[model samples]
Target: MSISMKLSRTLGTAFTGLLLAAAISTTAQASGDSVKLEKQDWSFNGIFGTYDRGALKRGYQIYSEVCVSCHSLNYVAYRNLMDIGFEEDNVKEIAAEFEVEDGPNDEGEMYLRPARPSDRFVAPYANEKASRAANNGAFPPDLSLMVKARKGGPDYLYGLLTRYQEEAPDGMELADGMSYNEVFPGHQIAMAQPLDDDAVEYEDGTPATLVQHAKDVTTFLAWAASPEMEQRKRLGIKVMLFLFVWTGMLIALKKKIWAKLH
Candidate 1:
């Protein structure tokens, strides 16, 4: 074959491969989105929205009491709890509940000490290997950015939490030790149903239903993922107002100049 013909054939083959890959990717994404997620009315949904402090606090309680056993919040500090409405003394107490590995002392030994407000949230396991070993070779992902990490955000999380099935559908054979979840991509998940009716008693008199637990925890995770969302929205509103005012002034100034010229 001539050089140009050979080159043309190679280009055609590459183009075909690219088209095939694109089709496969699109099909996979469509399949993934086929599972319709149920949306909840969140407190922080709109431009003027802000995090609900009550929900955040409840979510933290649920996370601390249950989810903390498997998942870690690596990015959040105990001090961050104060942002969600906990008092400094309460935060200090919460931090003291967990032990963290401190730096090497003059004796050149790493020592265990109570976690402080400045310290990051402690992981349940020291490392990935240990975490997987404890959970039957499945690694529990960190919850710090989970709200943002998943495609449907809080909606996906809420569904995953509340959509657990006691048994898999009649035809499907589930893998050993895996629980059926309607929202999970494969319909099988390693983590069993975490919430039950009245799983965490609410100190604030909120009903401790399973759905409430899911909602509160989702709200908390959303806040953890974007603690600055409220501030950002506030700043954005101010900037938009300034731009509107500036544009109005410019329009008035233009009219005045044109009138004087005329």
Candidate 2:
């Protein structure tokens, strides 16, 4: 082939490849988040983002009442609750509600005792077998890193909690235990709709609607996944400011030092 003809063919192929990649990306994004997933207004999103304390507390309440039955929050300790605005005494009281497996009194046998603030969040099932049995052979995942694990983060979780439907969409067929959820990766999820209106009594005047509960729980889970987000952001700001001031000082020193040479 002539040089120009060869170049034209290469260009055409490159353009075609780019178009194909863009199409695939669009399809993947549409499948993941298009109609079903709604973006949430989170307190902790941008550079100055901070957790919404009220929403965090309410989210914790939902997790305690509903999610704890199936999911485990093993990475979280009772003391961590204080980060979300719980008083120290209240955190202690909440921790004490659960019995934690502890010591082998000299005999090397494990025993159960009241949980403390230092104790890790208790798992509902004794073992994986027990947990799977309770959920009809489907293992309930740990909630500790759920928000981070998901692609869409908190919004995807919120959508899953609120978007379950009894009937599958027109072309979809669901397995016996699976239900339809718009935002779930494959459209069929084992988990049923977890929250309903008035499922839990809200201490704050916020109405206990399904959407509200989902939003609160999403906030709580987001905080769980990144409790140090605020600290990290703050540290980052301090470092940037230090660098800026240091750079100015160095520039001035460079000018003063060079004045002698000039």
Worst 10 residues of 2 by lDDT: 29-38
Worst 10 residues of 1 by lDDT: 27-36
lDDT of each: 0.94, 0.89
The candidate that achieves the highest TM-score relative to the unseen native structure: 1
Candidate 1 matches the true fold with a TM-score of 0.85
Q: Give residue 211's lDDT in candidate 1 (0 to 100).
A: 94
Give Cα distance to truth, residue 252, candidate 1, Å: 3.6
As for candidate 1, its clashing pairs are none
The local lDDT score (0 to 100) that residue 84 gets in candidate 2 is: 74
Model 1 lDDT per residue over 1-262, tens place: 9999999999999999999999999889787635789889999999999988899989999999999999999999999998888999999999999999877999999999998988889999999999999999999999999999998999999999999999999999989899999999989899999999899999899999999999999999999999999999999999999999999999999999899883
Cα lDDT tens digits for candidate 2, 1-262: 8999999999999999999999999899777645646788888988889888999989999999999999999899999998778899999999999998888879989998999999999999988999988887889999999999987898888888888887996888888888898888778888877899999888887999998898899989999999999999999999999999999999999999999994
The Cα error of candidate 2 at residue 245, in Å, is 3.1
